[model samples]
Structures are given as C-alpha cells and as structure tokens.
Target: MPRYNMYYPDYEKLYPGIEKRPDILRVLRASDRKMRYMEKGLKLERSVWDRKKQTIASLPSREISLEELMEDGRQQFSNGPTLDEQVQHQEELRHLHQALCSLEREYQLLLYFRYWKDMSQEDVAKMLSLTQQAVSYRERYALQRLKDFVQNGEKKKF
Candidate 1:
C-alpha cells in the first residue's frame, strides 16, 4: 500500500492497527480527497490575493491635493448660468407669479407670508389669527391649486 503518512501526521495514532482493518483503504481514500479539496481552495484564494495585490500596486502612488480631490478632474468651474437658461428661469418665475396672482386674495396673502417672508406655519397662523392646522391645510390647498393651474396651462380658474 502506498504511504499516506506525509499527508496525515497522526495517521498511526488515529487509526491504530491499520494493516488489520478492512476499511483502511476507504479511510485513506477519504483523507486524500479531503486534502486535495482543501489544497484547491487554498490555491484559488492565493490566486485571488495575488491579482488584488497586482491591481493595487499598478495604481498611481502620488499624493492628491485637497483642492484637486474636491474638483474630481473637472477642467474649471462655470462662470454662471447661460443667457438662455437665465431667460427660461425668468419666464418660469413670471408664470409662477401669474399663477399666484390668479389665486384668491386670502391664498395669496397666506403664500406670501409663508414663502416670501419665510415664516413658519405657526408664525403665519399667529399673525393671521388662525389655527396652525388651518394654516397648514390652507398652504397645502393653495400649493395644489397653483400646481393645477400651472399644469393646466393656466386656463381654468380655481
């Protein structure tokens, strides 16, 4: 029988009187298969580690400045919005203003106090002598009305 003493260090201690046992060959075969499987797993792990190491080593080693890192390879910052973009933005604002004007006077005042003045619902409610919940409900209704007006091409009145 071929010796398996090299692979299994405690072969003799684990399976004493192996020569007399009928299943000695079976035990040796199972041990050999397990060792081969473990060796394959180790080889695969080593190959993966080597590939990752090579990839890391191939990367640039230079230190990056904070400003350069923040820029993230952009050539330069734009000066400002283009003229066409500015005109489009202004037109949208005009439409929004027209929509606001079309709303009822109370809705207009509520929106003005809430948005243009940057007041909280509670503050606006206190100023207008209305409950906070009422102010919030009115604000939501006013915004929905504005959205409907804008989306419907400002044709219908609410």
Candidate 2:
C-alpha cells in the first residue's frame, strides 16, 4: 500500500514491519536517494545516446563516387577534437594519474585491476587473495580517497 512501490517493489516482503523501525526506514530513504540519483544519470545517458542516434540517422544517406570521397575526406574528418581539447584531456589524464599514484600500492593495484582491466570485484578478490567483502570495502575506500584528492585540487597527498 506504500506509494514507494514503484521505487521499492515488494517493500513489505523485503522489509517486514519497516514502518515500525526508524533505522530501517532511514536506510531505505538513503537507498531511495541513491536509486533516484542513478536513475537520473541513466536517463541523461540514454537521452544523449538517443540524440546521437537521431543525429546519425538524419545524415544524408546517398552514395558518393570515389572522386567525391577523395575530395571530401579531409573536410569530413575535420570535426574531431581540437588541439586545445586534446591538450586539456591529456592534462586531465595526467592529474588523474597523479591522484592514482598517491594511493597506497594495494589500492592502486585494486583500482587498476578493477577498472583498467575491467575485472569484476570477485575476480579482483581472487587475484588479490582477499575476501569479496574486503575487496569491496577497499575499493570504496580507495575511490573515496581519490575523490577527496581530486576535490582538494589534487594538492594533498593520500
């Protein structure tokens, strides 16, 4: 009967007597906030994807001769990132690398494996010889450290 069934389906089955427990209610509210945040992000991403698809679909679909292709190739590819944008992106990567380097070796390796190598948390745990829970904890701590470092203008050491 709760209005939040759209967000937390089967809420009664998942958290019986939730209304009687303030602690569980608080946790559920926090979870709802996180879910809403993620849902907004997903919506934004989907919108961008749809816009890109529409733009692509709206392009002319006529066939071009070899001479036309040769003549327009340079102009057609000139819409890439500008030099300033490329430089800025490189600088951002450098800043991120510095932040990553400031973390402890274990945290660095954990992030590298989990993100750079696209490994799952369970796989990372097996590789690092740690429990999944421990890996999860460390991953969260490490990301928080990186976020703090970046937010502090990347001047502070971890």
Candidate 3:
C-alpha cells in the first residue's frame, strides 16, 4: 500500500476515481477537518482530566475530614470478598492482569480506555492520534486476545 501523504497530488491518487468529483473531495476534506477538530477536543478534555487528577492529589491532608477518611477506608475494605470469593476473584484478576500486561503497549492502553472507560471508537482514535480504522483493528485484536486468554485459561483449569 502507498504511504498516505496529505499533499494534493498524493491524496488525489489515494482515493482514485473519487478525486475527479470536487463535491466528493469537498466532503472528504470536510470530514477530515471534523475529525481533526474532534481530536483537538479530546486532547483538551484529556488535559483537563489530568489536571483534575493532579488537583485531587494535591489537596491538603488536613482538608480531608475524619468521616470522609473513615468512609474511604470502609469502602476500600468492603470492596474485597469473603475468603472463598476472594480466592476466586484474585485468581481471575491475576490472570487478567497478566494478560493485560502481556499485550502490545498501544493495544493494552487502548483496550483499557475503550473497554474500561467506555470511550467511543472515534474518541479513542482521537486520543491515540490514530485513524479510526487503526483504532478499530487494535480494539478488535485486543479483545480477541483477551477472549483467547480467558478461554484457554478456563480450559487449563478444567
């Protein structure tokens, strides 16, 4: 495949017959512009989220009330399970964490953002500085890998 070049002559050849239609080219250019804008917006939002996380971290210890501290402790403790449940949960978590760690760097992070954070494909692509198609492929591959890991693990245990 030809390397994608944004220059007029190159883009014209990239799309082939569509290049002859000014209207189609206009639409394609508009779509590209829109995608660029969305990418910018996602970047700004990520920056904002980073700042928020930092601000929360930087809050004064004294500002955290005793009740709030107690509640946080309680919540953390309660999030775990009883002994047997804990064993099962821990096993599953360990396998999943290992699988996640073993994934390609980009695929792992993108999978987390897409699956855990519930980000849309377009949003993920924008955030990752990749095209929609690239994001789709990575997401599909990551999911398939995860599924295979889980299935094979279950088979081994049984």
Candidate 4:
C-alpha cells in the first residue's frame, strides 16, 4: 500500500513557546485532535473520494508537516484507547458544559449539584432552598431543554 501523510495541526509550530510553556501543549494537542476529526469528516464526504483511483491518492489526504504515515485509520501518536477516548470525550463534554453554562442560574446549580457533584436530589433541594419535588421538576425541565437544544439547537434559549 502507498503511504500518505494525515494532517494533525502542529501544536509546536502554532504555539512557538511550547518548549517553554508545557501547559500550552495540552491545548494544542486538543487542537490537533480537532484537526484529525476534520480529516475523518473528509473521509465521510463521498465527493472528495474517488473509488476508481483505488490508491492512497484517491483518499482526501492532508499532508502533515510531521510526515506521519497514515498507515491505518487511527493516528500514529495514539498511545492507547484510554487517552484517545478521554480526549475526544472531553471535547464533547466541553461542548455540553458550554451549553449548560448558558442556562438559568438555578438550573445550572441544580444540574451541577445533582449530577456533577453527585449530591442527592433532596440535598440539592435543601441547598437551593427548594422542595425536593421542585428540584425534580427543574431537573426534568432543564434536561429536556438541554436535550432539545443539543439535538436541534434553534437558538440560545438559555
């Protein structure tokens, strides 16, 4: 099989101080992951691929400056399933969290205390000066809103 480079945005070049500021690497790596996700998208797009070519050239290949080989569907730097899933999940979770952030203060706290902090519904009610039933109602309402927003997302209802 022929070899081709899959583009992963170079975190190092983009962040010139990666050598000095190690923390920045984490953010850049996340950007690199998004870049990979974009490449996957190209694979999903039928127009970009030419079946007749039947070679690596037929694929929508992006050249990586790192010159990493696109030997398999997965990337070379993938350490293991654990970290890769976590990073991808964290990205998705971040999107959900941003949506949560836009919610009313009450619903935000209710979701955070009950779900994130792992507190009981009763505990959340007491903390928020609400009845347990009220907390339950808000939880249902908030979750329904979030679900609709995520699936359709007409606008920022929050």
Over the stretch 1-158, how does candidate 2's per-residue lDDT look in tens digits?
Answer: 45556676655567788778888777877898777655554322221235655653233334444445666663435668999999999998988888998898999999999999999999999999999999999999999999988778666656
TM-scores vs. true structure, each candidate:
0.49, 0.51, 0.43, 0.44
Who wins the TM-score comparison? 2
Pairs clashing within candidate 3:
none
lDDT of 3 by residue, 19-96 (tens): 679998887778777665544443222212256456432223234344456867744345546899989998989988
User: Residue 60 of model 1: what lDDT?
Assistant: 33
Cα lDDT of all candidates, in order? Answer: 0.76, 0.77, 0.70, 0.73
**Which window of ten consecutive residues has the lowest lDDT sum in model 3?**
40-49
Clash tally for model 1: 0
Better of 3 and 4 by TM-score: 4
**Once model 3 is optimally superposed onto the true structure by TM-score, how far is the C-alpha of residue 98 displaced, in angstroms?**
0.5
Q: Write the per-residue lDDT of candidate 1 for residues 30-72, one digit (tens) a residue.
A: 8887776544443222212256556432333344444555668
Q: Model 1, which residues run further than 4 Å from truth?
A: 1-78
TM-score of 4: 0.44
Q: In model 2, what is the error at residue 61, expressed in angstroms?
A: 30
Residue range with the least summed lDDT across 10 consecutive positions in model 4: 59-68
Assess the local accuracy of residue 94 in candidate 3 as a C-alpha lDDT between 0 and 100: 91
How accurate locally is residue 15 in candidate 3, as Cα lDDT from 0 to 100? Answer: 73
Specify the highest-lDDT model's number: 2
lDDT of 4 by residue, 3-112 (tens): 33455555555667677877777776677677776556544322454578854434335444333355445465666668778899998787687678768898998998
Better of 2 and 4 by TM-score: 2
